[model samples]
Each structure stands twice: as C-alpha cells, then as structure tokens.
Target chain A: MVKCGLEIHQQLATKKLFCECNSELSEEILYKFERVLRPTQSELGEIDRAALEESLKKRRFIYEVTPNSCLVEADEEPPHELNREALEIALKIALMLHAKIVDEIHVMRKIVIDGSNTSGFQRTALIAVDGYIDTFFGRVRIPTICLEEEAARKIEEKDGGVVYRLDRLGIPLVEISTSPDMKNGEQVKEVAERI
Target chain B: MDTLRSKHIYKVKILSPNMEVEPGDLVEVKTKKGTFRGILMPKHEFSDENIIVLKLDNGYNIGLIPEEIKCIKKGIRRKKKSLYKFEKKDLPQISIISTGGTIASYIDYKTGAVHPALTAEDLIFSAPEIEEEANIKAFVLFNILSEDMNPLYWIQLARKIKDELKESHGVVIPHGTDTMSYTSAALSFMFSKLSGPVILVGAQRSSDRPSSDAYMNLISAVRVAKSDLGEVAVVMHATTSDDHCFIHRGTRVRKMHTSRRDAFKSVNSQPLGEVRGNKVIFYEGYRKVEEDVELYDKLDEKVSLIYYYPGMSGELMTRMLEGMDGAIIMGTGLGHISNEMIPLLKDFIRDGGVVGMSSQCIHGRVNLNVYSTGRKLKKIGVIPLEDMLPEVAYVKLMWLLGNFERDEVIKLLPQNLRGEISARRMIIW
Candidate 1:
C-alpha cells in the first residue's frame, strides 16, 4: 500500500471561518441555538458510520454565538457568501502546492464526532486536486485539495452548549492528507513540510 | 488493545453503608496511586472477587480491588431544580447583545461536558449578581468566544449598545478573557462618547467549576455598569486570590495568562477603580460620561497586528500592510526594531497606513527616543503607544479610523483615551 497522506490547517484571515461573525470566546452569553440530529437521506440511502453513531446517541447541540460572533453558526442564514478572502488564500496555498485548482467550488459536509463542529459536520469543499511538490530526494505527489470550516474550539464540558473556544471556530483551515509512500518518519516530516 | 483486556482489576470492599456504590450514583473512589471519581456502572459478574466498576469521566471503566480498597464516599448529589422564578421587572429597557462565551454555561449530561446554558433565565440564573443592580433586557447577538471575536461583532455590539444607552442605565457585556481586551478596546472606540458605562466582564474559570469567577465578575460588572463611569471598561479579578476586582479601561487591558483568576491587567496604566464587595471605588481619573454622547459605530476591519521578532523580514510587514488600513507592531525592548526594516516602516506610514508600536515585554512604556531604532521608527512616523497593550492599540486604531482620517489617526494614536496610553513612564527598566 502506497499510503501517503497530507495533514494541514490554515487560518482563514477573514473575521471568521465562513461568516462576518467574529469568532471568539467569552463568558457573556450571546445568542443560544438548540439543535437536534435529523439524518440526511444519502443517495445510496446508507448512512455513514460516524453519522449513524452520532444519530444513535441522540445528542443535542446548543451552539452559542457572541455579539461579535453571531448567528452564522445556526445555518439559519447562509454564510455571507463564502469569505472570498479565505477562498483566495486557499487557492494561493493550493497553487503553491502545485495542485490544479478546480474551476468551480462546491461546499460539502464532512461528519465530525468529537463535537468540535457545532453543525455535527464540517462544511468542506475541494478547491484543487492532483498536485506535486519538489523535494531534495524526489518528487512528492500531492493528492486532493480541501477547504474546510474549522471546528468550534472546546471550552468546557458542561450540560447544554459544550463551551467551545470560538477563537478557532470558522477560521478557515486547509487539510491535506497524503499517501503512505514514505518508509520512515523523516520522509513523512519532509513531505509534511513541503506541502 | 492488550492494555484494555489486562486492565488492573483492584478488589474494592465497600466497608460502610456511607460507601455504598449504587448502579448509577456518582462516587469518589480512592486508590493507592490516585483518586478517581465517576458514576458507578455495575459490579463485574465474571470476577470471583468483589470488585466495583466505575465509568470514568473519560468513558473508561476501572475495577477496584475489594480487599485492598480503603474507602468510598457517595458524592453529594444535588437534584438540579430550576433556581429561577420568571419575574419580569419593569426596569428601564437595556439591550444585552450577548456575544457568546461562558456567561450562559452549565455542565452537560449526555456527553458529560460543559456548554453554554443560554436561556435568558439561564443567563440571569448563572449570575444572580445582576439582580442587585438593574432589570435586564437581553439580545443574544451571537454565540462566540472572544478569540474568534472580529470587527463585525464589535460593530454590531456597538450598534446594540448605542441603541440601549439611550434608554438603559448601563450595558453589561459578558465576554471571554482571551480577547476581551480587544473587544473592549474596539467598543471603547466605536462608542467614543458612550454616556452610560459599557462594562465587558469575563470569568477565568467556567461557571460550573467551584472556583469559577463568573459570579463575582458579573456582580462587579453590574455595579460598574450602574456607576458614574461612562466608558468601555473590563471588570475582572484584580488578583489571583480573587479578594478584589478591578475595572480596566477598555483600551488598556490584556489577558496576561491562559488560566488565572486575575488574568486581565491594565497594560502600562492603572485601572480606573477596584470593586471590593459591591462598591466600585474609583482610584484613578477617567473620562466623565458626557451628555448627548456621540456614538461612533464603525470599524475598519482590515487592520492586522504584526508582532515583530528578532530577524523578522520586511516582506512580512509589507505583505500585511499592502492593502491594510492600520497596523499595530508589538515591537521589542523600548519599542526597537531591526533598522533594516525602517524604510518599509516609513513607506508604510507614508502610504497612509497607520503603524503604532507597543512593547512585547508588556510591562513598561515604549520610548523610541532612547535608541537609534526608536529614532528610526519615530522618523518613520511610527507612533509609539507608550504603555497600551497590543490588543488595545489595535482596537484604538480601528476606532480612530472609523471616525477620523488617516492623518488624524496618526496624530491621535498616542493621545490618551480611557487611560489607554500613559503620559509618563513608570521607569521599570
């Protein structure tokens, strides 16, 4: 197995990950939203393992948005057109990685179990795919480019809204997983740095 | 995997009825190595020895040695009854645009975590300290922490605060400590002429924790809100011991530690007053709440903070300033920088982009007159924020930009507002 993966996270310079909301943490209660899981019927009609597990738990997520960090979290309102600045930054990073940028971008959902993401799933989209970077020893082939919503930072484990550190939430991050082509830890580190 | 199968099964003997382990009751189990507290799941049936199993907070099961066990205390389980009675007081209408932090928080059961318990009643109940001061009308504008706080929230909060200031006695904001100073500073500038006090309060510990400062901070903030001080100020623990609380000017405070009761400090300036018990004793001079206060509800969010380090490139500064309206440089000792970057700094200033310097050391004032680098920065028109924290400088810059022109902001950068900049250095070096 040529197991190679890329792991990455980039800060979305925009005020928040995807909205005009200021992502921050505080002791003040801003707006409180309660959410319950409503499973989306997939095309295959088979729910993914993670989503099924979460659905079974019957978890209720109470998402909190401060005055500075507002209702964009509820999905009650569509994000103020994906933060163009963050998108541009992601594109720039993808280009630097020698990846091919996709002509169009479509936001997709990726399930998260740890409750870091208030929406139960993260909003992610592929900006580019199939790229490579130069290394001292050889060329490292990069596969897949993804732009995703950063998860809510966990603040404290309590009853209603799990106190998530808002500072890290909605900060656009870039994650790149690679195939396991490297035989040793040094190669993994090298490829990680190159990406 | 093997560790799970061969997990140490200590024999636990419940010697006293006081130590009875019920199936679902929470218990504090003591061991030779350490103490573990969790809900008692059940007794292991397969084991020949009488061992008790506990579901640890982290979701792991531990079996205790019955013979080697010393003691077990069933925890004081208090059934949570709603502590609030719905009493709508006909008090002056005030808008509480809650930008979410820990203010409306409680311990969650299913996930065994802590989260924001954000009903209006929950918020009020979490901090009963507010009842002594004013009747509150709240609006949860957003659910976010201070670190994630951005310009939009600040602007929205300012608008909400401005609208309420006309009718309310005061506005109290519960915010996160990490970036409370930044938000406070932003509000201070946005509501430059705010007549009623806009007090931003936050707790170092979660409300669920025994030592949490949420209650005290809220109480003090309410007092500050109702006080004669009409400015944006942060109310937080004055010291680690929590004996007193201090009222910090919005543009002068910063979170000094990640976790501490007294996390916020007035960088380079003294706090406006100290709140002991229920009294706000003003110890320093402050801007008097002016009548018909003009609210500046605008922000230039493009501004960024450029922290300088040894051998930092001019390219980084240039990139950040390329299209930025303002920049705050957290510079080295006495506000010095690599002289190589002086030309870029000068150009940045000339480009109509405001550049201000704050000491990274955070304790003392920034004086550009002592060294050549300082002189270079001064020549470049890099206004040194004598003793203001970096976050405060950023907020002040954003606020000045909202109402004043670039040139005017450059001139006003060093001027004191709400004690953000100190006129005289305390001479610590």
Candidate 2:
C-alpha cells in the first residue's frame, strides 16, 4: 500500500489571532511603517545560527491597514493573552479528530519567511496528538493538531497605488497533520476534507 | 557523584558569561509559585535573573524564585554539543542573487524549534519539484527584506546573474514581494535586452507551512528558467486557482495584494506568457533571446515615490522631491491631484527632479490633460506615464537616474521602455 501524510492549514475568521486588531485593508497606511525581525538565541547558549541567517535576509514588512482591518496584528503590539475564542475553536477541531488534549496550553514559535508576519515567526501550539479520524476507506491516525497565525493577504502589486494590505495576519489557523498512510491522491484529498 | 540527590535548595541564576556556577551546584531561590525542582542549563545569557532556570526531561525551560523553597537536585552534568554545523556544497555552476527575503528554512522535528535553513540542499528539498527542470547550482548573495532593498542590491544581483550566465542555464531569485516588483523592473532596465529568462519568484506563504506556495512558485520559476524564453521576467501565479501561472515582464509587473496567491500581475499590459501543466507557453509579442547578453547593473537608490491626495501638503511632496534624483507621483483620479500640490511638483521638476505621473486607479492610463489639475501638472514638467504602474515608474526612475541625467529621464519617462507604458489604453466597452 502507498503511504502518505498530510498537513492542512486553514485560516480563521478573526482579524487577528490572539489580539484585538481590526483585520482590514488600507494602502495609504501600509507605506508609512516598517519592521525588522531578530532571532532570539536558542536555549543551547549558542546563537540560533539559522535564525540569524534568516534574519539577514531581513524582509521589510509593509502592511496595508484599513480602518476596519486595523487591529492588534497590524499595530504589532504585544499579543493579548491568547484569544480564548481561537483556542476554543481549535480545541473543538482537535476533539472532532478524537485526539488527546494537553492540560496546559502553551504557545510556541513557528518561523516564517513571507512579509505577512511582522514578528518573522507565527506563534503556534500543539493542542492535540495521537488521535485518529475515520474515512470511508479506513481509519487514519492524526499525528498533530496545531493552531497558528495566518499570513497577510497579498494586495495587487501594480502602479498608481501598490496595495500591500495585512488585514489577515494573526487570524487563527487550524492545522492538522496526518500519518503517512494514504495510498493515493484521492485518499489525501479525502482526509483533507475530513480534517 | 550523585550530588543532585541532595534536597538542599541552591538558588542559582542563569547567566551567560563571566558568572560562575559549578556543574553540581544546587541553585534555587524562588519561583512564581511555592517552589520547583531541577539542575542548571549549561550556558546562559547575562540577562537571566533570580529565577533559577531548569531543564525538564521533555526539554522545556522553567524559572523558579528563591522563595519558592524549591530544592535543587543537581543531576549528572552532560557536556553540551557544539550546536553548530558548517558545511559547504560544490553547488552546480549556478548563481544565487538576493534582492531580499529568505528562500528556505529547516524546522527541528524533535523540539518544535524553527530556524532558517538556507543551504542549496534546503532550496532543493523545499521544492523537490525543481529537480525536474534544470540542474541548479545555488548560492545566497545577500539576505535583506524587500523594502530595505535599494539600487545596491539590484546592481549586486544583476552582477551575480551575469556571472552565472556562462556556466549555468538560467538564474533563480527567491525574493520578497514588497519590493520585488521594483527590483524586477530594475533588472528589466539593467538587462534592457537579455538572452535568457531571469525569473524572479517569491511566495506569500512561508516555505515551512504545508499550504505554502513556495514549491509551486519555485517549480514554475525553474520551468521559466529552463524555458527557451530569453528575457527578464517575474513568474508568479496567474490566479488564486493555482491552475495556471503567468510570466510578467520585469518592467511591467506589480504586487497587487498583501497576501493572496494571485498577488502578482502585469499592470496595464498582458503577461509575457502562461504556464499550464508542465508546459511553458509564450504568447506572441515576447522578445527572443540572442547569443550574446549585455548586462547593466547600475541603479540610483535615492529615487522616491510620492502620492498626490486631497489636502496633501506640497511640503511633504517637496521633501520627497527635493534632493531626490527622480520621483513617481501616484496621482489620484485620472492623473489629477490638488492644484495646491503643484508648486512643489514644479519646484521638484525645476530643481532637476524627474517627475512622472501615474494614475492611482491602477487600471487606467494617466491623462494629464483631462482635467485642469492634470493640465497644470503636465505644464509643471510632470511626464504622464501613460499606463505604467507606480512600481514600474519607481524602477524605471532608478534606472534612469543611473543611465541618464534628470532631463533625459523626463524625456524617457513617457517613451515606452520594455513595454512599461502601453501604446493604447485597452479600454473595455
């Protein structure tokens, strides 16, 4: 049997994941600000050389913030305590996959390259693991369930006005990765819908 | 040997440098709670404080205060690994030029840690789909954000691309979108005429995410690179559907969205070609590659783009226009801005600043004579960029600054260079 796995990332509806920033679009404001991302040293005492290396490719973040879309995510203010609404929604998805939940939820960093994320990394966490979901064909084990921040939506990049809106950054993303057990593309797509 | 077995509460602070802490020392002071347990991590940062940090079996950090009464059970001290890997591969005679942005990254599967993985291998593995196209030899010339990108990187990238022209088939540039259009336009102007496709590709999604557009973009880039098309262009997705991709001339493309798959588009002009299935199709009207390639990597970074809006202060426009070699003003409403903003525009022009006007509507041509404000702007030495995108104007302005004086720039802004300014505005009836 052909074995395959899947990692599906779905964006949430909120403007910002854990912050109260309005998620909207405005080009005039995007051109006014700037951001630089630095990688923190790993616990191993040695600098996270990879982070440093990536930071070198310093990608300037120019966000298009509309009055309706402007929010904590756009402001780049410290995140508020994790959004309970996002967390609960994530937990519900985890439960649907019949995964084991952890008692205390903590956030972790997932490095990103696109300019969509201002922090250079999206905050994510594993809420569930070792779960299984049933498909019409058979039962597939779920390896991990994570919640993450979505990247900014890309505005058209032409003249007159070059719009680079960031109304979508910080939108919660529900991610689920499956074990490499699928045999074909159909199975993969099927599991994606189920997850 | 098991001094860690003792229940003595040794308050130890995590320090990076000159601070002293023995291997088996029991250090504990206080915790946010009553108390906690564990031994010290080998090396620490100087900023660490009273809360002794401990490492648990699962590889996590916890800080405890001295008052927590936490007893420190010092454990066996294991020597830490060097935490470094230095490797250099004999990359194929390929060249990597950076305008801005990291192309690849590696995430540690063990500890949920993420870091930039920027090796040729990382580029290959991140987009395994490339192996099907050209045999790539890659190198990273620089890593900077697209916004901070200036004429320096543009010149540097062009030089690098020229260096690889002899040994490699084509070049692949992983760049950021914020200023990618500007760089692409600069390259288009520098290589005014090229022999092979120099494809600049970037992704809205980071490579680490499963839904990242990195693979597709890279594959399409490689396809463009390996194609017979001899030109400078930006290859990006054609639509959000992911079914088709488009090749935009470096001078004509722009980033239209903040975060969509179909963010890149050819402004006011048709795309050079489209990529479907495994095929790269060139629609009519693309220049063919020649045997000899001429390279020009010169750029002037002091150029600025100003937007003319209602209530806009001429001071702001003047500040941007003053001392600036050239400027592209994104005028509002059919190439018209407030008449109040014209003096600075005139002053900027009179002061040797090359001023080009583009419509803010993005889809239409700039009609400088359509309105009184537009007429005044034209009279004050503003060259209306027929259908040129603002991004195109920025790059063209930079290139013009490098090749010609301000007067030449004013003369050339309206002239069609590499299809930047459309001959006729394709208006739909």
Candidate 3:
C-alpha cells in the first residue's frame, strides 16, 4: 500500500512573526552585515545532524538589510511578542482541520544553520494537533499545525559567501503537516487541497 | 545604594535589599509579570529612573519598571579581571600595534559589552596559533575607536611603525575597519620606501562569537607579514570561507561594505596577492623595489573632501574652500559639478587654493574633457585625478600640501605616486 504525506509552508500576509515590521520583500537595500553560525548541542546532549552539516561547510552569511527591515529582522534587536494575527490565522487553520488548539503557546528554537535564519535557528510554536482531513480515497491524519518565522530569501550564492535579504526574514509562516494515511498520490493531492 | 550612585533613584529605592549587588552581578528579578533572570547591567545615561536594566542570558538588554519588580535576588558574582600570558618563540619577530577595534576585543560575559583586549598578550592568548609563526611584541598605541581617528593619529601611528620596524621583520596593526583604509592609505604615502610589510588587520565580528573573523584575519596577516612582501597592505578575508585572504594595496583599497568580512576591496586594481594556507601568491606585474625607506609624516589638516550632489549650494562649497590648503571634490560622473559652483571654484583656485577633481563613481577614471560641464570645471583650474579613489585623493592632497608648495601639489595630484592610480585598466577578477 502506498502511503503519502504533505508538509506545506504558507506565508501569511501580515507583519513579521516576532516583530512589528511589515511582512513585505524590499529591493532597495540600505546596508548589510555578515555573520558566522555554529551548531550548539540540543537538549538531548546531541547536535542536530542538519545543523552540524551546515556548520561543517564554514560559510559566511551576509545579510542585506533594507529600510523596511527593523532591528529584529537584522538580528540587532530582541524579538517582541508573537504576532497575534499570525497566531489567529494558525488557530483558524486548526479549526478548519478539526484539530485541538493548544491553550498555551511555547516558542521553540529549531536548529537550522544553513545561513538562512539569522539567529541560527527558526522560532516555531505548535498551535494545534491531532486533526483529520477526509478525501475520496480515505482520511489523512493531520499531526500538527505550527506558526514559525520565515528565513531570509537567498539573493545570490558565491564561492566565498551567500547573500540574503532580511526583508523576508521574520515573516510569519504557517506550517501544516499530515501523517502518511493517504493511499496514493491522487488522494494526497486531494487531502492537501482540502486542507 | 552606595553602588547605585546618583542614577535611577526610583529603581535604587526598590533595589535597596540588593544594594550590595553591583552592575556585573548575576541576579534574578522577581516581578508581577514573571521572574526575569540575568546580569544587572549598568543604567544607561538616558534611562528612566523608574526602570532597572538587565542583560539577559541571550545577550539582549531589557528594562523593567521598578514598580513591577517585586524583589531581587543576587546570584554568582562575576570575576573582576583575568590576565593573559605569552611565550616568545624563535620565529621571525612581528610587531603587533593594537588600536581599538573588534579584532582586538572580546565581549565581557558579565556585562555583555565589547571591551578591547588591549595587550599583545591578550591577542596572542586569543589566537594561540600565532605564537608558533612569529615572536610577537605588542604595543597598545591608543584605545580610541577607529571613528575618532584623525590626521594627527595617523602621523603618530606612522612614527610608531617607523620605530617598530627597527626591531621586527614586519609590523601588524590591528585596527577598526571603519577608518582602516584611510589609515592604511596615510601609511602607504608616509613611508616613501619600505623594508618590510606593514599590514592592517581587523575583524568583522568580535572574538567572543563563534563566527568571529579575528583568528583567521590575524593568522593571514601574520603569514603575510612573514612573507617576502615589503609594502603596506590590508589583509582580510578573500572569500566567505576561512580558506584564504587577499592582500590589498593600502592606497588602492576601500571599505566597500559596512559589515561584510570581505568588505575591503582593491578598487581599480587587483589585489597585490592572495595568502592561502602557508603560501603567498603575488599577482603579476606587482612592484618589487628595494630602497632605503623614507618617512613623510606631515599632513595638512586643512584639506577637505566634498562629495558633490545635485542642488548643492555654492555657499556650502565656498564655506568649505575658505582657509583650506587643498580640497578634493568627488564630483558626479566623469568629474562634473553643478555649473553654479564653477565661478566659486575658480575664485578659490585663483586665490591660491589647490583643488583636485576625482569621480564619485569609485571604479572609473575622472575625465574633465569628456563633458561640457567637466570642461568648464577644467577651464576653471580643476585638476582631474584619474582613477584615484576620493578618500585616497583626500589623504594624498593632505600629505602633498603638508610637504610641498601649492605649485607642487597641483602637479602631483594627478601623478601616479605609489600605485595610487593605474596607467591602464585591467579587467581580471
């Protein structure tokens, strides 16, 4: 039996997930800064394999900041409270999926050292769990719905370093993950569209 | 209260129980909102008296209102000071003259603030691998930030290098990247002849961070210093990787980007050479001269660099030209300025003021004969500085005015001195 699953990341049209800056891409850059990222041990006393792999490359990350980018997007200032609109959208998606909404939101740092996320990790918070979407073939189990900050958009990659625009960074992103319950690709597409 | 002093009076009253706790002390502040734990940071000068500042473990500083703070509990006391020691080896001697910048600094864990690692010992301890390459002698010339650097400091720094060269094979200056190119250009002109390399190095990130460029930059600089190179150059990251570094001529290099590790670029020319691993690969056609070194340390501080823009008034130009020995105009597109300023410029030049015109485009040569406005500028006695960077032109004009007469400066501003201008353009990346 063929089992299919889907993980969709959708950008929300609102302010950043953790700052008041607008969630819009900018082409006019004012300045830029460079950073080097290193992997840290996780709570399980082990480093994330993917983070370690990226760190092994030892590449420098250059962030091109525009006037639209705030201090938080540039990683110069601390993040403020989570975007309420983004959280509400995640809640609406959870309700549509027939999922149980979490009472308290706890933000987590997922190790991602690929020079994409300025903070070396993506801030993700689980909003809902255990929902199901029915399709023609069968029912697909929705494992989790998450709200997270998007990584900076890659502008150019060269031998010495990679340049990323901070305008896309910190933008609110909604992630929906489904279990491998769909019997075939057609069913998976149906469930994905339905969700 | 004794430690709190005259600031944050309202917070001081609330923090009476924890009066013994100093700024660097790790503390847990109990508030109605939550229990916040971090280092008790010194109050900012403009901070309100109603708030207490704390540096969180995540390296972020946050302010808490005194009224919201229920209680304060002090934690471990931070260490006051730590010393560094270095061992002299039998390797080639290199003098490290430290000027204030992130390259020669580390973050104080307690305060979460960057402080200069002022001694040679501190720098050596931070990058222990350098001890094997060179017998290092360090000197802390001044501790001011690179933004405060002036012509006088350049004179003093050049004199220090002249003195340090007597005892070492090369001199490595750890400087702030902000004004490093200027200092490097000044040094390039000050030393007429060089017996060894004088390298300026800086880090884009402080040593406290895991990604700091301090170690690699310092290593590359030391490698370049120990090589056969005998000129002033800025050694920095050639690429984003830690593989190698480029040696840029002091007079030709400029800080093109504010924050990139490879911010320093050799404009209108290729790098003098690239330092990879333990090898120095010099680019083709680079000059190799052997002569007794001469120092020209005098620089006239009256020279001004004006970057001309649209709609700029002649009064501003006249004000800047008044009493100035010389001025370098970074004119728009092929050395053209507003027509209104031509008469003012002519009056300034006719009154014995030396004026040189360089392009603000940064990559091309300035030609006053190409445009009508430019021709007008030339007719008004503006000397076109071909292919010279505006900053370099400014520094060169200052040096020329200090050492020579006005007539000599007019002749020398466009002359190819010390490889500041390339005779022909080469398009090798």
Choose the strongest candidate by TM-score: 3
Q: Ten-residue segment with the worst summed lDDT in candidate 3 chain B?
A: B1-10
Q: TM per model? A: 0.55, 0.62, 0.70
Error of 1 at B349 (Å): 3.0
Q: Please, what are the lDDT tens digits per residue for candidate 1 over residues B11-45?
A: 54464445545555676766543455666654444
Q: What is the interface RMSD of each candidate, in Å?
A: 22.1, 11.8, 9.1
lDDT of each: 0.66, 0.65, 0.77
lDDT of 2 by residue, A1-195 (tens): 788988888776654677776544444443334333333222222334455445435444455665545434543234677777778888999988988764344565555545566555667776766789887778889867888777776765443222346666777788888888787888888898766
Superposed on the true chain A, the predicted chain A of model 1 yields a TM-score of 0.77
Candidate 2 runs further than 4 Å off: A1-82, A85-105, A108-195, B1-102, B405-407, B427-429
Q: By lDDT, who's the top model here?
A: 3
- lDDT tens digits, residue span B287-312, model 3: 55344557998999999899999989
- Residue A137 lDDT (model 3): 82
Rank order (by TM-score, best first): 3, 2, 1
Q: What CAPRI-style quality would you assign to candidate 3?
A: incorrect
User: Top DockQ: which candidate number?
Assistant: 3
TM-score of chain B of each: 0.77, 0.78, 0.87
Error of 2 at B8 (Å): 33
Say which prediction, candidate 1 or candidate 3, comes out ahead on DockQ.
3
